[model samples]
Target: MILAQILHSLFFIFVSYVLYLKYNNGVVKPSYIYSIVFCGLLLFVFNYFFKGLSNRLFLFLLMFSLSFVILQFMKKFVNVFGNNEELAKRKQLKVNVLSVQDFVFKKLFIGLICFYQLLLIWVPGIFEKMMENQ
Candidate 1:
């Protein structure tokens, strides 16, 4: 289980890094990509640590701490990115320039990455099923 959680966390981190690269290359808007990556990392860490807590009270405390970290990250991100009108306009222009297919593909790719991470963390049985089905 620990190995599975580690692999899942690594997978999420890799996917988020890919998104970060895409944003840097102007393939996607930084605001959305950064937000998504931040959230993904938070979820990854939450799942990783949640499995280690044996006591319910400890688990709840860990979850609360994770929530606080997530909230603080978002607040800081918004402070840096949200109040900048120029950046917002530029990102909007970039988004507008994306083709429908490109937009759909990006969304689908992120969805798949997130789903795979969740499956690895919460439903290893599903992975076994997929392998059997194959």
Candidate 2:
């Protein structure tokens, strides 16, 4: 079980870093450090709760695949929205094209993802306690 937890934590960190890098296209900004902090906290919480789950290997594989797919979908969606807006603005200005150079959007997106992961690890515990009280 300890070994399984360790493996799962390592894999989770790896996948998260991969997703962040893919979204930023290998660009490492200062904001990406949140990924490390969130991953660390997530691993600690996951290992504490790890013993309850059976078939850790299978679940880890499933989670990794799902996260990758979700990240790809979100990236595509952001690209479409950003591209469309840029195109509209450029057309109005009668310009050929303009590339997205804003780092704010990517940073905000990554920060939200990190926040969501923290909530995922926390909110269930909160709800479980509430259920016990009732």
Candidate 3:
């Protein structure tokens, strides 16, 4: 059970890493093929344990899409604030961006990342419990 949970966490880590790479480079690296395969294994495990396919698959699709969207937003925020030397000079972890709007967006993006991270942490366990319940 512990091993399964670890694998589940790895699934999220690998999937997010792959997405991060793909978003940055727009090309899939040969080395990450195995990671991709591991992710597929989890998906298959989900499919195998859960009897119904058509309806549940939509939920999975939405999960992946939401992840992609959050990643894109992260990239955009980084790009928007990434250029300034002033932001780089800051001592604290928090930065004071150019305007209130930028600050709000930055906080929002950070919140989204935190929320998504929690989702990644809990989702596999949720799937496992659901599978066991069936």
Candidate 4:
């Protein structure tokens, strides 16, 4: 289970990095990278810290914390990219928008990876008991 968790974390980190690179291309500023990485690490820590907590209240808190970190990252991403209208316009002209097929495929790929990790976390004894016949 520990190994599975480690692998899942690594997979998520890798996918997130890839997503960042795809969105930013080669023009991402260094400060933005630092901010994004910091936010990502915070999310990771929050996730692992709350993994064993089963109380609804604590779970809600953790979820909120995680969401906050992700929002911070998104804010930085938008501030760095979206605010640069000239750069964004130039990039848009040079690069094709991701095709619907490509977008859907990437979404499915990431979703499956996340779902598989969730299954690994819940299998055998963890969440299985919740579904057992009474």
Candidate with top lDDT is 3
**Residue 41 in candidate 3 has what lDDT?**
64
Cα miss at 125, model 4 (Å)?
Answer: 6.5
Per-prediction TM-score, please? 0.35, 0.38, 0.40, 0.27
Error of 1 at 9 (Å): 1.9
Worst 10 residues of 4 by lDDT: 53-62
lDDT of 4 by residue, 1-134 (tens): 46534544454555444544544344555766576566455555655675532333223323433443475466556644345566566775424333443444344444454454455444535445644654
Candidate 2: what lDDT? 0.50
- Ranking, lDDT, top scorer first: 3, 2, 1, 4
The candidate that wins on TM-score is: 3
**What would you estimate as the lDDT of candidate 3?**
0.54
Error of 4 at 68 (Å): 27
Q: What is the lDDT of residue 126 in candidate 3?
A: 62
Ranking the candidates on TM-score from highest down gives 3, 2, 1, 4
Question: All models: lDDT?
Answer: 0.50, 0.50, 0.54, 0.47
Per-residue lDDT over 1-134 for candidate 3, one digit per residue giving the tens place of the 0 to 100 score: 34543544455566555555555455778768786676656655764675323225324533754665676677676775567566677734225444554544444444454446446445655645755798
Cα lDDT tens digits for candidate 1, 66-121 = 44336435655565444556757798654554444344434454555455555545
Error of 4 at 31 (Å): 11
